[model samples]
Target: MPTGLVALLDDVAAIAKVAAASLDDIGVAAARAGTKSAGVVIDDAAVTPQYVTGFHPSRELPMIWKIAKGSFKNKLIFLLPAAVLLGQFAPFLIPIILILGGLFLCYEAAEKVLEWLHVDETTKHDEPAIVEGHGREEEMVSGAIRTDLILSAEIMAIALSEITDEVWWQQGIILAVIGIVITVGVYGAVALIVKMDDVGLHLATENEGVVAAFGRGLVAFMPKLLTTLSIVGTLAMAWVGGGLLVHNIAAVGWHGPEHLIEIISHPLLGLFPESAEMTVGGIAFALLSGILGVLVGAGIAPLVHRFFPHGAEANE
Candidate 1:
């Protein structure tokens, strides 16, 4: 009986070790997946601060928290299950769906550009009665969540594609980890960004020495920073969208864009020294891809506006 009990304990220990190892694997996979989704992650972080622009300082963190929760729900509740189901049953559909999502990103970026250029003919009418306080906050939160849903979906999909040959449960666990980590990271950074000027102001008023100067500098830099973030966000959307389309097209069969990028990138290889060739090539390729994304988005914007005439001029 004692020997049997010892054997049982040994079995338990083995199982425990296996479970711990699996947890470790999940952590590693989650981190790797999050890293793979860097572009979308960066875009998500960049785009989010815009929603807090008009809000009172007190409202910023709460709104961000709400959006972060929504982003978590988007990934863990909606996209994760759907992705698993799709991976299990309809793996073939992944690329098509991703391509469609990419096109939507492109369209959004293009619309913004057209609006900025004053070339878009869509007109906007102000809301009937302006919402106040809680209602306005709700609207902003909802809009931010809606945008986050798309970005989260793309992030989850990108993460999903990075995973290979894992069992469904493992994939799910990894995805959950990634979703939580990314949501926290992106929104946490955004919360910091939106409150930076406040922090600066506090420091400037309450502190002394170089800290005050630094605080004043931060205050001076914030508007430009916001503007830069907006531009970067738009460009990131286009670059990511274009990359997805190009890579997926190559995955299916056509390699035209891929080949073109490589060809365009090739000249940079010679211009830079050997060590920087890859970096230069990558930059060249990204630039070309971003341009392609912009062109594709611009081309499709008119069609989208024509078909969806109702809210064409709506600010994204």
Candidate 2:
């Protein structure tokens, strides 16, 4: 081969290798970021199906699709640039933003808890009801998206924190990947979860023998599963919200809550073998944070309802 031709081919090969390495780096970073946000991801999946609970079976998927689209918009359109810009220009504000989002989560969770306990009948009846159809669906979808905005912010913030060592553009790319992949993964799982009963019903009708029995079992289990998911979702909101507050509060220089959590969790950590201590300590801290979140929620809910009655009603 001619020398010039050989040199050109070598240069192209080197560029290709560089591109491949960059892609690999992005993949590894995105996965790492996604894993760090798994707790919030679980909370998101747990919380979402409840929104579709009272809707007709056929509307479930469509509603979920709408919410999923909104989730995409929340992460990509709104948050991705904001994360990159904020991380670059205003890193100090990230914690504060998380604190505010945490408060919103706590407030919502507290309201739900009150409703569950039948202690908030006045707020319940005061909520505006639209005639069933597009209006109600829009209301539910918007509410889900609003809740999702906070969760998505947490996810992106977590992901961005993981990738801060990368160059700015690389951080943006990794966040975009994490945003798309996690959103798809979360909402896809939710679709499967919400539609499992329908799947079971079809299986029960279309199959026979052991398959039919299993289908019947699935059908029987689904309602209970959904109910369990609702409860779990509520707890998850409190846990995640409170954890955010505890960690961010400490980040912003108030170590009191963090110290209290560590003190409380110390004995719990001691009960475990050394190998399991980290996991036990984490769980202990999470439980403590969740309790804090519940208290914060309870404290804020009444004030929010009193000062922002219409706003609170709209959330319901």
Candidate 3:
């Protein structure tokens, strides 16, 4: 080969190797960040299906798609650059933002709890009211996306924290990868969950034997499952919110709440076998955090209703 051609091929190979290494780095960072954010991811998944609860079956996937697209816009378009900038220039602000987001989650959870208890007459009822019209659908999708923005902020923050040492461009690439992967994973699961009854119905009608039986079972089970998910989602909001508050509070120099949670949850570890102690302890801590969330939320709820009475009334 000509010397010039050989040099060109060597340069091309070196560039390919560099690109491959960058991809590998991103993959590893994304995985670590995603794993760290799994709890929030699960909460996001759990919280989403509730938005589509009263919509028609045909609208379920479409609504989820809308929300998913909005989620992408949140994490990628808006949050990705913001995270990069903040991570580089304003690291101190991140925890404060998380704390505020936690409060919002707590407030939302508390409002739902108050509504469930009949103490709040301004909020929507527990029974899924068939909300009609494009306007209502848009409202619901927007709300879901707004909630997603908070959760995605946390996810991106977590991911960004993991990759803070990387170059700015690399951090952005990894964060983008994490954002896309998580949005797809979360909404894909939501789509399946929301449309499960439709799949069940199809199988129940078109198949027979065990397949039909299972389909019938699914058809019957989805409503209860959705209800369970609603309840779980609410609790998840509380726990995630509370967890954020406690941890971030500690991050900001107030270790009192964090210590309190440890004090409350530490004893529970003894209730389980040694092998299960970590799992039990973690659950205990989460439940404790959730209790704190409930308390904080309850405190804020009355104030919110008093100040934003029209906001509640609008929902009604």
Overlapping backbone residue pairs in candidate 2 total: 0
lDDT of each prediction vs. the true structure? 0.82, 0.85, 0.84
> Which portions of model 3 miss their true places by more than 4 Å?
1-22, 53-55, 113-122, 126-136, 207-209, 266-281, 310-316
In candidate 3, which residue pairs get closer than 3 Å at backbone N, Cα or C atoms, i.e. clash? none
Best of the candidates, lDDT: 2
Candidate 2 on 63-91: residue-level lDDT in tens?
A: 99999999999999999999999889878
Give the poorly placed runs of model 1, Cα more than 4 Å off: 1-17, 112-131, 206-211, 270-280, 309-315
- The TM-score-based order of candidates, best leading, equals 1, 2, 3
Q: Write candidate 3's Cα lDDT for 226-254 as tens digits.
A: 67766776787788789889988898999
Clashes of 1: 0
List TM-scores for all candidates, in order: 0.85, 0.83, 0.81
Q: What tens digits encode model 1's per-residue C-alpha lDDT throughout 226-270? A: 777767878887788888888888877899989988887787688
Candidate number with the higher lDDT (1 or 3): 3
Number of the top candidate by TM-score? 1
